[model samples]
Target: MSNSHYDTSFKGLCYVNRVRMVKPSKSDPYRAVTLSVKSGKRVSTEGKGDKPEFTIPLDCKVVGAQAQAIFDQILEEHWDDKKPPVISAAFEVGDIYPDYYVGTRDKNAGKTVPILKGRLLKLHDVYVKGERIDTPVETADASDADTPAAAQPETASAETREDRTVDAVAEEAASFPSVVRLSKDDPDFEERKARLKAEGYRWDRENKAWRRPAA
Candidate 1:
């Protein structure tokens, strides 16, 4: 696909299940490595439940210093824990493209697979056996849940609290940004409320907020 056809940035926590160096082929002069990754919010699941997995092929020849550091860390974890590392990476697809293949031994011989041609922009974190250890990104927001109320602004009005909550919740719902809390007094609230409940939003009667997991 063209560069404009794909998203500018791709972010996810990919659990590496396996890694191996690929021998150079006639079409490609340099060797490469394939990272078999499980798609999930976190690798702690150990690839359990309903998460899907895929293989991302990265050229090892030009992985650069940053990518090499992450690869080295992953190799260390693999050797010590005998388990693959969970790597969080942000990817761009400007130079990356899909490659079609056809082989007798291949399951989907005629299908195409996306070959990551761009260098790894950043290695956000690494996990061993589902436990996070190394992280390069700021995690302050993650600790907000445990922050003391006294540390926050107490002078903010109720309307301000409601507005902030709505904005925060809206940003979290990247896929379903239309999701919102409706009051019981609204004419169609009862009808739509039931559907939201079934979809996993929990009604917080005390706070008057309907919350679901962030996107």
Candidate 2:
């Protein structure tokens, strides 16, 4: 692993970071290497020895080996496979180099996503052929329960609780016996109601509904 540091005078060991990459062009077949050499952040327009530099995005799962090798080969004037390297390497739109697409190598479908540098690639709201993967449920468990998200039970909607209509709402107004009016003096009426709720509010299983103390 030769350090590609840009200090022509002093050079021995250098480390490179994988930033974003772009697609390579015909003139510059080899992907452009965006490096932070001593000259600051600049794109290597011309690959080693007069060959045009490539420009590719870096969001794909490009292994450290592939990236480093690409850089080395381009810098030396020795491109093995001539006709526009089919790009066997992984690349993505935002990857640091022209490598592989992130989701392009998902061989096992939704079972697993590739772990790149200890980071998992997530595809949320995923589905296949109009079939959704995440199902709708209710009363599985408290959302905040200490359980791995993968193993956590799916939550059920409130309507599934009492077989109530999904669009229905149970307002406490119907249960009130007296006219509970609000006054300008108590501008923070909602706060008082919440405080009272925190104190204690329970449902009576026998009554089949909620029960509140007289105000």
Question: Against the true structure, what is each candidate's TM-score?
Answer: 0.37, 0.15
Tens-digit lDDT string for candidate 1 (100-123): 444445675665544444333334
lDDT of each: 0.43, 0.29
Q: Which portions of model 1 show Cα errors greater than 4 Å?
A: 1-9, 22-31, 35-64, 80-94, 104-106, 109-117, 135-215
Q: Candidate 2: worst 10 consecutive residues by lDDT?
A: 5-14
Candidate that would win on TM-score? 1
Cα displacement (angstroms), candidate 2, residue 132, comes to 52
Best by lDDT: 1
Minimum summed lDDT over a 10-residue window in model 1 is located at: 136-145
Error of 2 at 117 (Å): 3.6
- For residues 128-181, write the lDDT of model 2, one tens digit per residue: 223333322222221122333456565877767566453453444344433233
Which residue pairs show backbone clashes in model 1?
none
